[model samples]
Target: MNKLLIVGISGVTNGGKSTLALKLKELWTISSIIHIDELTKPMNKLKYDSILDYHNWDEVETYDWERIKKEVTISSQNLLNSSRQLACLLNFYNLHEHHPILFIEGILLFNSPIDEIFDIRIFFTLDKEECWKRRKERVYEPPEPPGYFEKYCWPLYMFYKSELENKIKVDSSKSSNIPYNINFIKGDKAIDETLLWANKEIYTHLLNY
Candidate 1:
């Protein structure tokens, strides 16, 4: 029997967290994914910032972290109980009884309160220009304010990045709280290239497990 691992995919907005999660699911049939956006507070419930004149959806407080943690914990427990699907990972990876992966992906995952649940964490780093370019390509309801990207999104992302780095530094020194099994991947690579690299990393991790 292999351990049940909760994998966290987190990074800047439009940084391909969800895309990579879906690709991983396609590759590993037995794996399950939980997107953080699905558990966020609705528009009406979100806090509105009068200065920015838009809802502050980019902060850590906007997500119900407790509920998200509970759901991940419960789902992870359930995934561990399934003996039939467990064989699929072993067969696919050519490893005997490899870990069962439960992926939780979202922009704010790294900064959230669920650090204890992650066995492996992958953070995508994107240049600000690339991030803005991708944001422009997508359309959102209640359309982004005139300066949303500049005034709100990017700044918040930087803050979160700094926050995550600080936590990593603390954990590295103390070796107590957050697990040190974190991989940083550049987000500008082609999707196939990123996917291939991620597949290799996951496979290698499983080999050692």
Candidate 2:
């Protein structure tokens, strides 16, 4: 297959997008998964003056978009020479597939340039309180201070929601007017069920040659 299949899984922090992406990656061993969180890096480390001196990692600016777009475009297009070069860059020497499935997951992707590249988009959802609880358990380099969640995290998440509210839906499958590429999934579902649903959708696009 010379054509690539690109799947996007996006949602709020602790909304289970990574868990699903990892499961999908493991299911299809040849598949490549690009996680936005892993791609994130702060702009500077020496300029720190106070607790708030560091850039907010939760915000979208921390990610390297130029690198991401280039790699993702190459992966999706499956240009043979580009594929080999990218594999070398990523240090995965064994990857020989010319057209591999690409799964990209991130916290905020709706309004970004990265959002427009996916062939299929899946957005996970969970209750705000549940998300907050899970987010608290996760660690950050510049640790989130007291009132940070209330002031920064929650507010930014809400802003994200506001941008996507009119554009996306909670249950796109139930409505015929919804776009075929956009899918909504509830993160509270059983892991097996979620994986089953995800695998079904992914495999449908991968008609066995």
Among these predictions, the greatest TM-score belongs to: 1
lDDT of 2: 0.70
**In candidate 1, which residue ranges exceed 4 Å CA deviation?**
84-98, 175-181
Top-lDDT candidate index: 1
Q: How many residue pairs clash in each candidate?
A: 0, 0
lDDT of each: 0.79, 0.70
Off by over 4 Å in 2: 45-54, 74-99, 169-181, 207-209
Clashing pairs in 1: none
List model 2 lDDT by residue over 1-209, tens digit each. Answer: 23556788987777888888888877764577778776665557223326654456556676777878877866556544555566676766433333367889987766577776777788887788888888889988766676677766778777876677655554353566535456778878887898899888766655542
Model 1, TM vs. native: 0.86
The residue-level lDDT of candidate 1 at 191 comes to: 82
Model 1 worst lDDT run, 10 consecutive residues: 89-98
